[model samples]
Target chain A: MEPKRSKEASGGSGRPRGRVFAFPPSPQRGVALYLQVADQLRGRIDSGELAPGDQLPPEVELADGFGVSRHTVRQALRHLRDRGYLASRQGKGSTVRDRKRGLQVNPVIGSINDLVQFASETVLKPVSVVEEPAGAEVAELLDLEPERSRVVRINGLRCERDGAVFGYTKVYVPVELAKGLRAETIHSVPIYAQVERNSGIEVAGVEQRISAGGADEELVEHLGLEPHEPVLKISRLYYATGGAPVEFAESFHPPSAFEYVIHLRKGF
Target chain B: MEPKRSKEASGGSGRPRGRVFAFPPSPQRGVALYLQVADQLRGRIDSGELAPGDQLPPEVELADGFGVSRHTVRQALRHLRDRGYLASRQGKGSTVRDRKRGLQVNPVIGSINDLVQFASETVLKPVSVVEEPAGAEVAELLDLEPERSRVVRINGLRCERDGAVFGYTKVYVPVELAKGLRAETIHSVPIYAQVERNSGIEVAGVEQRISAGGADEELVEHLGLEPHEPVLKISRLYYATGGAPVEFAESFHPPSAFEYVIHLRKGF
Candidate 1:
């Protein structure tokens, strides 16, 4: 069956609406004029009314339908563009972008061996290494006194060969344990391996907490993501053989850039 | 050291601006007025100009300061509210909320036994069950024909004893293998166990992909979340003992309500 056009779009006629017309945009109402237009447009895109590659109505027509100025339409377009929803060219009108478009990096990380293998596959670019006081959360995770304890915070961006950063990891080490570590050495090796080699202490186990969040300014700058883009936040607390929390790490991954894979098996 | 205010906020006086006055909201210049206001407000919150529990300036004061209408201020407040940054009380004004609000659940799932134990700890509330044609992503993951393959989809909300929903899972079973599974049976038993019992086949392993996203309309409704809240998205492909993908599952978790934990141990 053909898609049904709204009464306003059909103008009380049974005929299908033109490509350039769909919802009869209402006056500003209490909502911001541009937000009203943007929300409607987003709804259309989400509902498949306006599909990928589909050109939105010209600014003048949209202004006329929405009973707003061309500036309002432009603002709505700009908002969509900033949010990775629309693409505009010099002469061509704005087109709906495939919102799900991006690079797909699937890394299998289940066992410690898998984690080691994944670290080997990626190039670690150390950005900064500094000693700082641990915050309450970090201190709790690392089992240190919040205000009294200092930790060496190592910031690194993990990437593939092309230099496109998929995620940024912040590794926190107790100052006492970071005596001989250097930022330069971290670039060539994973922190786990470096920790083991430098300290002669084995990492017996690790506890990780995985969650989701929107990109903040730092993430935007590092990952080159649009504002409010989704990111995977993984926090890990590495423990020594006797269950002492040694290293606490927080890593953020852009949704499209990385796919974290875990293999789960059933037991007897 | 005292925080330095931006030049605009300082108004050339060189003194940090008071909380009541910060960024001067510009007109809708190519950007959505609410977005501009929201971005500035978020910046102030992030910069600690406005601390948690601090009430925002009255709408009239905000309108006068921002050069926008009260409606625009309300829209900006709504945006922040939906993003979990602001809380509006009935009689009192809008207050800056603790951005890091909510419970943290960290369940460590290391071996198959751990997963089984985790499932046993949580009760599953089946929401709905239906048979439908597979979508592109589901089909691709399940190794089935998109649009042609049929599958049984079961929606469930995992809750604790207090009835707080921590996460929701969508379990998809290929029609051929979903013979005797019913919604009632799913309420008491985990899907993996049910699949094995019903089909007389063992699940060899599950390949899981974890990502992050903002809560959509469906998630908002089911999870009782504010709009645009962050959620953890986990996709699992269950392979039968023979290695054929049989079940495709997607789970969405509110960050405050759930924490997926994985423990990795070093090998010789």
Candidate 2:
């Protein structure tokens, strides 16, 4: 439905080579017209029909083509310019510029159990598992006595659809509890769930410490990341129903591959 | 309380010239000995007694000084090494290293109202305020008709306790509602809260989109950020009880100054 124009916008070749947008002016809708036009233009740019440095058709042609007034056409162009999508010179009209690509990864940030839930969408591959003396660090993190304590360390990689490992995880569980956790099932079940199944302890809470750090050599190779690239480092501690610390784990995620998103409710 | 040591852990020199830690070997407690020792060492480093590049007393001397076994001392040192606060050389022994400071700003990730809540702890310095015709982009974001809509734009900086601006925010509100918002009150009250106070609309929901972006010149100047530093960009849309969009705000936060944290419960 095209808005009837008083006079077809003058002085223009209406053709824009490829499929141009059909923005019929609806004066009643007033507010969304220019944005709709801009969205269409953005689409064209994204689709490569409007190449970088390609000058847009004159204002009259755009107005005539979209069946909107010249004023709306100007507004659309200005919006695009503000968004870094277009460059306008005095005599050159408007030229498309290299567009900024938005973020690629948007991970849902949630509970430790969310990892197991994500297993439904992604795949986990076990790298190694070993039983070692629970040293001072592990003992402190997991609430185990250092000198006599033992821990089972499970190393794994969480991979996406394309077989790219997005994160490298190291999970440490008490040796007493680890005996019941099968290595083969590590990929299919969440670590916390496994801990619950084996130890008969319900996970009461999880404490997560998140920070950004430069990737070390090991992560650079395991995640195929560039050396010193920024990575999201997460350390998680799991506590039992009675507040006994049960497990400690650390994971490194490349920024390009994952983003943690959280939703907040007011006054919760 | 220091644990009585067995034979004072036989070793060479007891005098290292500074106050060393008092470690009691609690075999009964089992798990946290090494961590306790590590914490003391960390404290000494932080206290400036163990200067960077200063050799930690030999492990034997440390064991004797702390009245702990050599194994426990080694465990503590290893823990410090992993945290980037200390480095161990094959023949030279452990030396203090520059520690990587964790993120300084950890903001509770919550609703748009949280921004107003934050004002209680800090201060907002207004930069600019103007009433302009709502362009297509702003209209679409705020769910207003472009031709008839006008928006009140407020640009400001959110500064921390040390008089450093950590974020830059731009808030847009429809002119009809913006009429009740006073520029003077914008610093103390969130725009949405003000809109609710004046327009009698209780906000029911908020949609937030967050991503990371490289700082542009504007952010660099306002946030005193280094060129190409990462910034967290958040776009929030506040909706009234009936889902009528009421406010559109965008904020940029320097990575150093703020980290958004959200706690998620299981099965939420």
Q: Which runs in model 1 stand beyond 4 Å of their true positions?
A: A1-107, B1-109
| Model 2: lDDT of residue B189 | 70
Off by over 4 Å in 2: A1-116, A127-140, A144-155, A161-168, A174-177, A209-235, A251-257, A265-268, B1-119, B130-140, B144-151, B161-165, B231-233, B254-256, B265-268
Give the alpha carbon lDDT tens digit for every residue of B40-111 in model 1.
Answer: 888899779999868898887886666556777787887786555776654568888665422222122233
Worst 10 residues of 2 chain B by lDDT: B100-109
Q: What share of the true interface contacts does each candidate keep?
A: 0.70, 0.09
For candidate 2, write residues A159-214 as lDDT tens digits: 87578888998899998877688877777677778888888988765656555555
TM-score per model over all chains = 0.58, 0.51
- The TM-scores of chain A alone, one per candidate, are 0.58, 0.56
Let me know the DockQ for model 2.
0.05
Candidate 2 lDDT over B69-188, as tens digits, reads 787788789777645467565566777864433221111123334444555556567888999888898899888889688899888897764576778888889888877888888776
Task: Give the winner by TM-score.
Answer: 1
DockQ of the two-chain complex in candidate 1? 0.25
